[model samples]
Target: MATPIQMPSLSPTMKEGKIVKWLKKVGDKVSSGEAVAEVETDKSNLEIEAFDDGYLLQIVVGEDQMAAVGAPIAFLGAKGEKVDAGKSAAKPAEAPSAAKPPPPPAPAAKPAAAPPPAAPAAGGGGGGRIAVAMPSLSPTMKEGKIVKWLKKVGDKVSSGDAIAELETDKSNLEIEAYDDGTLAEIVVGENQTAEVGAPIAYLTAKGGKAAAAAPAPAPAAPAPAAPAPSAPAQASGGGQVVPLRREEPAAAGGRRLRASPLAKKIARERGLDINQVRGSGPSGRIVKRDIEEALTKGVSAPAAKKAPAPGARPAAGVRPEPQVVPLTSMRKVIAQRMTEVKPGVPHFYLTIEVDMDAAVKVREEAKAMDLKVSVNDLIVKAVAMAVRRYPKINVSLQGDHVVQYSTVDVGIAVALEEGLITPILKDADQKGLQAISTEVRELAERARKRALKPDEYTGGSITVSNLGMYGIDQFVAVINPPQASILAVGAVADKAVVINGQLAVRKMMTATLSCDHRVIDGAIGAEFLRELRGLLEHPTRLLF
Candidate 1:
């Protein structure tokens, strides 16, 4: 039987996914559980694995393209199977139809005074011109960057013309013009970032003056009546010099830069000091060309120089040019979550040093017996066991209430190439040392490969973060939200200790606990650590 490969729902909030790359082409033999493509979800990149064995017959979604959830991305059948690829493509349109019910009310949610309907007056005093503001494209988007402007000044734009591309935090999307008119002015140029409601351009009536937001205002109050030149002045090129003047920008209001909207937008996008860009337009007004010239010649504001100290030596060569890269979806979410939890939750820290000599000996003996175990594995087991004893620390702080857990689920922080992911270890307190080690290793491997499912990464009562492999002696970790506490494990090193008035060397390790003060008090956190330390020092208790 031929099986249709549909796009899987990778996350709870994922509406669509981009096909990053296809690993198996048509006519290739594929087996169940084999990765057929690499998909980019909203959070991270993951492999799309096959569920049935067959020959790869077709790929409906190409690379670097998006498809809604349940869309048929590919097809699999026998080697000589004849598949209708067009039918596969047509079936996915139903998914978008099912999703159309939620978006019709979005426009109604905006304020009644939104500029889209009343744009003509906002654009200019005349009814012929229309204002064009940045559109809110996504539910979470607060601002967007103009990737590029497809339409230029004086260009005619009609409804549904893709006038510009916007880069949101999630993905780059194309935006269309709503009204048909001449592009009279471009307020926001290529690469400029603007708020959702901020105006970016203007549209004027056909054959109307393209001057609603044009640069170089006409001179006000007319030419002076008393001014008269008896003789023309000689030009530097042997021609007569002509005096050209323009209205002082202050006449309209306070002093303002005499620049076109596009020029200002370009300056902002390129991080150039507009004041330093020499204007070349009428009355020495700045324009788009001036900005381009400044960028081409690398003209920037002068840096302030400081006197060196008496014995300070001059540094060597010029510094490399700085580069700006946009943040990934995972990084953005991590930043937002961290910012929300840091000041919002009142947190306190507690650090304790543990003697790991006994656990070290046990690990050595286990290695000799062909049983592999890591210090982190032991720490995870210890933390889980301790949580089972002190359920207070294994609880979350909900609004006006505290929720306790019946089972101990520990989260192990695993760092990836771009960001970090925490995979949960369920029922850790009941699992033996060997089982815990196996599960942690498997979870970590899948996490780095981005192959774990949503359930595998969510729902942990507490978190364990170990920096011991990096040779970090001691450090504190931030609390993962919803959970009240997190344990930071440091490297195990030999330290000098005094035993019965005699100096002795011992294996010492340090662990820091960061707890939410709203839920677990200082005494409760300390008690939890004490129990964890006891379990770690006495490894025989873990065996029983």
Candidate 2:
């Protein structure tokens, strides 16, 4: 019996996956639990393994192809049995020229052997087109510039291999090829920008001979003649082309020059376009190396008028110029989620000051023992212990029910190059400070590199965001959706306080807990924070 191998749902949020590669080909024997293919989800690339021992029958989804979750990607059959090759593979012939006309086979022209049917063009080979969309490089990036392509038309690309580099507002990011296939076409060019989700290229599963043949004769035509000089001059000046004057010189000789005092001043400062420089100073007398100095400085020549400040209303005669950028997929999601949380959930914040002298001393003691635990790790441990005592704060809003989690999965907010991401430290209460610190560091490093798996970013019962390293005295963070509260930790500071009627300086830290009103009321949230403060103030409670 043949069993259809459907694309497995690797993550709860995964809608589709791109086939990275097939480890086994048709007719190869696959054992249960053996990796058969690699697939890339939105978050990470995962290996797809075979579930049962069988012969590889067919690959329905070619490498680099994307299939919706649960779609058939391959098939398996009994070992040694013939497998269906589907609609591809050539059919067997009935007979080979029954009445063969022999003799005098030599031809005058040989017909050029039909040019051996030129190999299918890179991306057009497959009958169907696979759209390569512009990738969102950052959470706030709405569009990206196609800086350059790493793969050209007809080049074969494998999964995980960089296909192009995209420039977002934040930084340049390498985009990977989703499937293994010939790059069919490049719809976007270098320096050209496109919105996220827009098609930047196309990939065909099979090479297209017809499309490949279409460009063979394109280079035969001569290049178009250059446009008239005046046309370019007007366009460069941001104006419509004007007819050339009858008295104008047929050709402007080398360095046809002129300059003004203001032009020279601007030139010295900016390295301006001297030839295009217009002098506002007294009668343009080709002032002392004006244009030359400007050109050397590379500064913008004087404009006809000054530009207004950004977003400022223009005068009656002028309309304000505005630049528009589309919202990127990541940015769009962030905006939507933020709006939903802001208005839909009633939020209340509780702030408390904790004495961190003991906590710092404990950390110093741990460091002496070769355990370099961070203040964050200490806070995480304290929060986990507090949650164990006050479980109500470690719950999420799930429709009519408040889902309380038994185990503590603490989400430590990390700032990545792309944006903010929170990776979980599971069972934080069960782990020691050193273990939590190591895991948090590893997760943060991975988050910055966009290498975190979906599981790392999901299933956290609580979240913690700290800006103490940055010297933030105090701040409050919105609760992550579904989760009841988020803890914001501020920097530890020395403050003068009255202890038993004596003024003394003590190390103190401020923390603010933002709770979702539906899941955690002010009293419950405050009690949790009080417990956390007590643990930090005592420092030994975390160990117990």
Candidate 3:
């Protein structure tokens, strides 16, 4: 009897793979240990061979298509035998997205081998446990540290409750339950690390036989789940059934402001202090209607002075006894990314100097109005405005696709004791100088306290790394992966230069832009720098 050969799990973490190409054709003779097709896995592309001697009968899954682990890809059988695929008991496979045209009728052969059986139920909730796995908190994250467990074994939890807080590469994130269940077991303990997609805990369905665990059909993969609970869910921070982030009053310096994104954007645009408009939405969350009402009530926006940079503690001598300190998640990610970027990615550098006298004058005027405007704030706004002209530099290379982002989201790299995190200033191109200044200050403060959410620090079109506060004249920065360019801003110091063909002292800052050669060409990088330099030099134009 002809049998379907299921797709094999080449890598432990690979849930599915794209069929790159088939090495054999339909009706071709396939023998055991013969390579039949190539599959592109999560890490790399490898050839999948046949496990049994048979003639190729039919290709169940086509080329350029994806098949889930343990799904059928092709059929294999003895010569002169015809298989009835339609009557086969296997569930038909569907394309994840827009299905590509089926590959030309060619030699259909057996898969390299069958996938291994699923692992035993986690949390010891055999056949009924809803195991929660570690999700990828950030795009480049491989694993996460279990900071602490909010729920323990035998504790009943409702849908949308935070089960645990996982320390990711970028920030500390809370993973919530999608369905009501009792925590059956804790597979990973506090202060330990687990790879993404690895089970950290298990849950038993509500009213189940025991508080042990439930199977997939029972409590996993809820209809409304973005990362269905059955698998290591993507921990969207907040999902529909239960919100990870409650719209409670979050600290903005001392004042707590809770508002919807639309309301905040409207408030920022109207130059109104959102804090003045009391929220009337759920849990006092300010909505768009509230902002409109406030506008009608003649509420004006107030410019907040940027938070003062915290002063460093007094220098103390090292302790007499030496001890090794464990590396943080941030530090570990930085080390891995730094190691891969140097040798794997090609980089080209471009340096440009800007006269900050105009920017300096603007800052002084802002200070007179009690607004805290810094030199870096000006650069951030300028870069945001500059990227609008050349959108290619603001795109990311995702697999084979070049994803052009819709907004000029700029990342402001904030230095911390453990490491550094780049908090995204979303839609910076549309924001005013005051908004950028205040937002950056607030983000830096949260970053230092390790209170930032994943969305705040990930997915930026470009990054601005300024070392001017450290008294560094100029230095190039390594490119953050996937981003085409990173701007390195240096200190504004008195330098002798020929301006208008005359030697004069001017406050000049040198900026170096490190660009990835694969995504950005030299011409595009130069144009962006030229535009940035112009915007910073003519500081007044940035307002328009």
Per-residue CA lDDT of model 2 for 1-544, tens digit only, reads 6665656555445556555445676567898777777665554455677777888765555544555555445567776543333211201100111122431123211211211121122223425455566754333446889988998998876533567877665445566654445688999999999875566887654345323322211210100011111222222221111111111121223322333334445555664534444321111223334355545544442322223323343322122221223444663454456547777766789999998899999989989999889788899999998997897777765434445675677999998755788888977877888889999999988777665543466657789999999999999898877577899999999999888999989998999998876556688987898899999999887887
Q: On residues 251-272, what C-alpha lDDT tens digit does candidate 1 reach at each position?
A: 2232335565677778899887
| lDDT of candidates 1 onward, in order | 0.63, 0.60, 0.64
Report the C-alpha lDDT of model 3 over 146-192, residue by residue, as the tens digit. 99999989999764466898887777767766446789899999999
User: Per-prediction count of colliding residue pairs?
Assistant: 0, 18, 17
Better of 2 and 3 by TM-score: 3
Which one wins on TM-score?
3
Candidate 1: where is the Cα deviation over 4 Å?
A: 1-342
Q: Each model's TM-score, in the order given?
A: 0.41, 0.48, 0.59
On TM-score, the stronger of 1 and 3 is: 3
Give the TM-score (vs. native) of candidate 3: 0.59
Best by lDDT: 3
- Distance (Å) between predicted and true CA of 183, model 3? 1.4
The Cα error of candidate 2 at residue 301, in Å, is: 66
